[model samples]
Target: MSGLPDRTDVLVIGGGVIGTSAACRLAEAGVGTVLLESGALGSGTSGTTAGVVRTYFPGNPLISSLAVRSLAAYQEFAERTGTDLGLERIGLLVLFTDEQQVQDFRDTRAAQQAAGVDVELVTAAEAARINPLVDERTVLAAAWAPEAYACDPPAIVRGYAAAARQAGAVLRTETPVTGIDPDGLVHTPAGSIRADTVVCAAGPWAGTVAAMAGVHLPVTTYPVEMLLADAAGSAPRDALPMTMHPSSLRIRSWGDRILVGMGRPGPDETRDAWLQRVSHHLGTTFPALAGQGLEHGWSGNLDVSPDGMAFIGRDPSRPFVYAAGFSGQGICQAPAAGEIVHDLVLGKESWIDTAGLSTARCPGVPAGTA
Candidate 1:
């Protein structure tokens, strides 16, 4: 049995990037905030992310807007806090193999350009010129978004946590939140923290934490596995854009080595099994990666909300809040998300309309989704 005690102004669950970020924003805005993680900071989806920053998406239009806004926010955050969290603007390279896909790429490119995205359509040869590793035969055409980038996710969360603490927010790692009492107490393995507002940013396990508060979020878990390639010894001369292969594989160069992500798997697979499936899939997809050897690999579970957008607002029926279910698209949106969540908690007006992210956006979700 662990000791649990009394209450704070706000308690946050799943101390990953989103939670840490909410804490940082709230604290900086003079709101009392405390964050509790089951393990270490950034130990979940935020830690092992490919850190691929992209402004190109076929479906979600909010993605393009958020990507651009978040990119600017990341740069400004780094300069403001002096947090060089390894954020890099390496651009994005989306290759096509067939005529149909090329047309599709063009359609997407046109959509991006219309949305004020700085992008270019390049020939396969031009793509090869940008990155010599890209073969002309395999790549028929490519969509290039020069504004896309990458970052070291775990380090970014750490930086946010540090800044949050310095601003008077309480961050407790290795301190798993057990539940959220209806009466405003955050029960944890270490103790109980009292708060008027509770935020759940548990990523894949977000539903689990919401259930602790008698909330049923229609979110399923899907994990993606990523492999780290052996360093090429010298720094990569060609700025490797985030490359998305037609086969659902994403290869990203991280300075010395490359991050080969098998991409997000479906919801049927268990949290642990997704990695194995992705690893096997990645090895089969990339013949070039066969003998070079895998330096390291990891899996991060993602929570897919019913609507595929995040739940980032206060509880309509209960006294709590949340920012979950980015569907693996959280990093690029974190900057604006943090600001929105802080304002929502304080009932302050926010420019970013969070109507689509309310817990009420989907019925039966946590009252906090309101």
Candidate 2:
């Protein structure tokens, strides 16, 4: 990672899944691309993602489309990049206890089905059959997507980085971007890089990176916690699917271990209190797993937008494009985000409608801001 390039066609800041994927797409299109990462690839939020891949966004069409497209790319990842992402096509089961939630899901199911997503509303019995971990008595209905998957997040970052390298993108790990000028000069610890276009995909730190260029991105960072516990005694007979309850507790089987994720803890909550809350929900939802000892716990940040959507468009005043504010859906939506970045950088029309994902859509930002 020596001899910092003085100039390139594109400079991508961040080495997470989104940045690497954008670099891969740009380089594949014959653009001279340079990617800079402050730390090791995927060492950020991408490394700690729950890696649940599903196309059920309820009312968001943009996210649903991006997720579906990303899922397809992930399925063909090995064929295109010759890299294994550890993709497991274990279905997704979303359990709901409220009648209104069930009706909302039923309404959204039609649109999802029309969009080619294999999703359906099922009864409690049907949901239990798909994932026996759920307490059928407490569930009113569930949404089932047979094409959902759980993947290895770090492997995905590595796979995309390798593809970008092979496609002629210069990738430098540990090369932190220090400053950026509106005229396309990117300052780094090694040296400065000048490029015709730049992209900021720094995950949770994207707002900080964008501010370096004098642009304001309304991205908020929040922490998400997850735990892994041994489910040897109560493990389902068949491999369990990624299961979720309305309480924002997500559980999925990883061999003999169960990966459990809880919603963001309150600002006043301590780590121990958050873990206790997660454990309480886990035990209450599945009585069989009561008193299970957790093997590991970790936390990562999510860059969220006010509307809970991503910003994927060119900056109106800066000489750069940005892809951020994934709102915890980065892993499942990264491939599409990369493609959108490539299209915006090249001044080409994206295959999907990206009007709603622009930074201008954010509240308080002027219209046409991005």
Candidate 3:
């Protein structure tokens, strides 16, 4: 009783943003919580994220609402913990390429407005004023969300971990979970942790971890790559907005550097070929970033579900097991997802409607749904 206990009320697997945030909330509520991470906190996908936080997700009310709540949580986290989240609310602009896409933007703007998101439809010229990177020659229109922010993912993860520790949660790094049982036994190289409940926030490895517990989760992993470059003459004078292009490429300002990201391409494409493609894309869209020499690059696996939305909630059959499938929005949804996990473990009413987000709602990996 004087030292770390062998048993805890909750055993959280994974030390990423989702796990640490849940641990923070659970410990703040006086639960005996233990969080185990195979590697350092935020060193996985959380570390490689683009770190864009916004409440506009086209037509999804659940994600938008959760994101709105999490933005407030992020601000509170920075204020209370004295942690600089590097939260630059420089806004987000998604450019449309054609009239049909512009109409889609109109519908999306309506949906976002219905969900209480502060979004507006801007002309191509106005979009250029916001980021000065839009290709006015081909742009049809744009959807702007001024409340969005770009943050430091590592700082956010560490902030949650620090708060969890201060609230009495025990966090152990390099303690890889070897196996898990339905009876609440977690096996690790360090030792066994007997828990009353287990929260799986393992990201890409969630499916593997679930199998050890005799459960199957329909989660898949894909490699997503990003590029970084110095903002000497390639970036705007002021902070640039997170710009999403129709080509699925996203570019933003990360301090004095430009961050570029896109979904993974085919295996035949080499890194040099990909960079050339990215350069061409930038030349066509921004023009300012054309031929800009990239200083760094990295890649990480994105844990995605069949429906593209996250699968959050406890398993109906295994009441003690909870899984949070972030689907690449972990940083934006982690704060609220953590609270939802806490509510599930404590048998309390969640702040938002989580009925539709259950894993049971997932259709289980359809043919080729990304």
How do the predictions measure up, each by TM-score?
A: 0.84, 0.96, 0.93
How well is each residue in 229-292 modelled by candidate 2, as lDDT tens digits?
8885756766788888888888888777888888766789887787788888888777677788
- Highest TM-score: give the candidate number: 2
Highest lDDT scorer: 2
When sorted by TM-score, best at the front, the candidate numbers are 2, 3, 1
The sequence of per-residue lDDT tens digits that candidate 3 reaches over residues 1-370 is: 1333589999998899999999999999999999999998987778767888888876676788888888989999899889999888889898888898888767666667766789888899998888886778768778898988988898899899999999999999888889887678889888888888888888898878777876677888978888886675645678889899988888998778888887766689987787778778877888777777865578888888777788777766664555556778888888988989999998899888877777667555322111
How well does candidate 1 match the true structure in TM-score terms? 0.84
On lDDT, the stronger of 2 and 3 is 2
- Write model 1 residue lDDT over 48-116, tens digit each, in one string: 677866666654566676667777777888899899878677888877778998776666665666655
What residue pairs clash in candidate 2, if any at all? none
Clashing pairs in 1: 5-192, 7-193, 7-194, 8-194, 359-369, 359-370
Candidate 2, which segments miss by more than 4 Å at Cα? 367-370
Model 1, poorest ten-residue lDDT window?
282-291
